[model samples]
Target: MKKRVKQPTADVPALDDDGPFAGDRQFVGALYRGLEILRCFRPTDGPLGNQELSQRCGLPKPTVSRLTYTLSKLGYLVYLEDSGKYRIGVPVLGLGYACLGGLRIRDTAQPYMDELARHAGSGVLVGLGGRDDLSMIYVACARASSVVSLQLDVGSRISLARSSMGRAYLAGADEAERTSLLQQIRAKVGEEHWPRHEEEILRAIEQVRTRGFCTNIGEWQTEVNSVAVPLRTPRHEMPALAFNCGGPAYLLSRERLEQDLGPRLAEMARKIQTFGST
Candidate 1:
């Protein structure tokens, strides 16, 4: 039987002691909630109604309805008049591409991703994590085989606590930043599910810090395995890019991952960083 996927709770708390409205209460809440609603549409074709969105987000129907209407007015969402549904609009696409154009790491990482995919017969991805947050944004992706059903794609965002790509970025972050992010993740996810194995997680981070690469097996998704390394720019001391390769679990067992793929991914990160410099 397939393992049950853990669902996020409805009333997850804010990341700090100051509560949800710590900074710019009303405006920030609206902006955050609106973005959350938008993020829920990914990995699927969605033009969800108010009820569907409310259920998905565990937010009130009235709140979702208001947010949807407001987003539609702001040109971030489009209402299908005949179908009575809503979809992400042109503005979001425009802004997404605009953001992509500004990231130096994405440009440098794509060629390496292509090379990795070609050589390994697996999918490669590059992700950028928020400076003050633990979430990762998948910036670029290259795939070799169409048979694999990896849920991630370019422009996707994932929680740091649940993904190896995100954890790799976290591992490379400075001590203060890493601690703050871990605290934030714990607050958002609650203590029970936030740290799967505290000792193991810390040991992995330490190993990544030493070897400059990370590996995982069935951490994010059951029967999916991956390895990642941090990419640093010449000007910065810390990582600006996170590169990963993912494939079926059986093909990427723990022993082979540590013995073979780990070094290969680290080498790819170094090459990508060099390319970024020139």
Candidate 2:
């Protein structure tokens, strides 16, 4: 007798769900599928063929072909004829840089991030979440030591479903906004991998809400840990930004993080938030 193999299931939710953009049929489905294709590229996959993309996105080969063609035509992706693969295109980089230029949060928070890095002897990052999206843009960073380096840089984009900074912001978001963002992330990354750390993530968010800070242990990057605190403007309607300090686990132990570094980060967040008012 042969052993059975469990087939993988579609991880995304049904488009008919009464969440996010509830009744917008064609627009939502196409948008979701297109984003699914682009997300197939990762830090590792240098470039990928239509076949690989199809397999990864769980879309038909013809659909992947059409989507890639449209993306190439729109300048969001480029095709390599010889190798028959595709990679992120130049226009996206230009747009990303342009967006970074417009964000003033980085300028306001740089000094605070620098102070945190200096005092804590760790790398610090300040980021702002996209208003209607489940992603965060790293606006500022200050590195204290050369031993540990986070691959992320200023202007780097990270998913809200997987990052401490993103989660802290989301945890602070209003009920309706948080639900919408969660729906979008699930629609994009699917349920399986998207919810890999659901319980832990929820707990982390609650802790952030309760303690006014958030900590992540080997969640986003293996062997690396981080702590973050939210920065809110005077109105306190949304988290205007967030700041975090991170490094190798050896240097970012829970005891030091809670006792020593947490207060410094909280103080920095307050100063950044206050500065944003002026």
TM-score of each: 0.78, 0.75
For this target, which candidate reaches the highest TM-score against the unseen true structure?
1
Candidate 1 residue-wise lDDT, 142-211, digit = tens: 8777565466787676656666777777777778977877777777777787556455457668768887
lDDT of 2 by residue, 160-267 (tens): 767777777777676897787777777787778666656766877787877777888888788877777766676543345666777778778888777777777877
Which parts of model 2 are misplaced by more than 4 Å?
Answer: 1-22, 25-32, 122-137, 155-162, 180-198, 219-222, 234-240
In angstroms, give how far residue 93 of model 2 lies from its true place: 0.8
Alpha-carbon lDDT, every model: 0.69, 0.70
Q: What is the TM-score of candidate 2?
A: 0.75
**Candidate 1: which pairs clash?**
none
